[model samples]
Target: MGFVCNGRYVLEPAAADEAEKYVNLLHDCMEETYSAIADPGFMVRRRAARDESIEEFMEEVNGPGVRCFLAYEVPRWTSQGGLSCAVGADIEWDAPVGLALSSLGPHEWESEMPVVPVVAGTRDLSQLYTRATTHGTGLGEALLRAVLADDEPAYLWYIGGNERAKRFYEKFGFQDEGIFGECGGIWGVPHGEPGQPLQTARMFRGGVVLQ
Candidate 1:
């Protein structure tokens, strides 16, 4: 099923190749959005993953437990180039992205506390740039609704410093679980300065059913 918001866009499951595009699109989105808020170099170093080929990225994406979806235009173009949004769930294990961030000690948490018993999901809403220019609209809320349609308890980590993102996540009923220390360096932030810490907030949605 798909949702058309404002009469110009649709949200649907992303095709395989389309999923790859969304990854690249996210890279671009991070570049643009982060640059506007922080230094350009900071954005590139922190959010853009380097040295991985598209095929490798795709393989990583298709690995066990990963699912992705996209929000595109109604009349799909040859390019299918519109806002490419995605949500990935790491079911039984943590994602590579998650693992890498956790490896950087000092900020890492020691948990006798097992991994949170919940699905972890991430939605790339910043990819709406192309569609935004064409339609003068944004479907972040729509895409988010689609991503959360499963009704399972899910969570995402937001860079503690990004107020805008924190606000966005709150609109979806997410609340802070705790500071996800050393976790925000997913894309390699405070680059090359290994010990530099980034703050993270673990936000959750849906309530636990007592059954």
Candidate 2:
């Protein structure tokens, strides 16, 4: 999918040409994200298990119905390397400060869907990351709108305690689907003591047309 976008960035679909660069950008994004809200213990474990995370990212990037749009800080052709096939502000940064990874979910979330004409199965906003330094810039918004315009009835698992994220996502119509308990285990964080709050929640948006 492609888009006609207006902003400092021109978004585009990522191609195999951007594969290695994407990996580099992805790690950068992950490091920033985990830094903000991840448990210290989990961070230690994740660094040690870095290879495992990299392998997972590779699978998702190549998997069914997944799309990645990179936000570039400069024009697409600024590189001697070839990413000629890329188009739209999936924003492409030669050293990207923002990335949005999306995938179409396998199952229906009919109960969760509203009247909007969203992608049939849920579209997962699997990862949305912007470098901390670009926090005030519209880089995140530009990257998000590019991906959302292409797919919707979207959902994501946002880290808890991020009021900024919650507010940002709410403006785009995502609603809290409730906190998730399994994230502690999923991220390799030790289970919280009884009644302790965990840092994961599911949020959902449209895709249910009620046909």
Please write out the lDDT profile of model 1 over residues 1-211, one tens digit for every residue: 3534543454445444644455555565555445544433554563345435355545644544444455555443222433332112112211101000011111123232223433222322212223224322446655555545545455566655677667766777777776565543343345555344445555666763211
Candidate whose lDDT is highest: 2
* Displacement of the residue 53 alpha carbon in candidate 1, Å: 6.7
Model 2 misplaced regions, further than 4 Å:
1-7, 16-20, 75-94, 106-120, 184-186, 190-198, 207-211
Deviation (Å) of 110 in candidate 2: 16
Model 1 clash count equals 0
lDDT of 2 by residue, 32-138 (tens): 76665665565556556666666666766787787788765545533333244244424435676667888776334323323233445567787788778768667
Q: What is the C-alpha RMSD, rounded to one decimal, of candidate 2?
A: 7.1
Alpha-carbon error at 128 in model 2, in Å? 0.4
Model 2 lDDT at residue 66:
78
What local lDDT score does residue 195 receive in model 1, on the 0 to 100 scale?
Answer: 41
- For model 2, where is the 10-residue window of minimal lDDT? 109-118
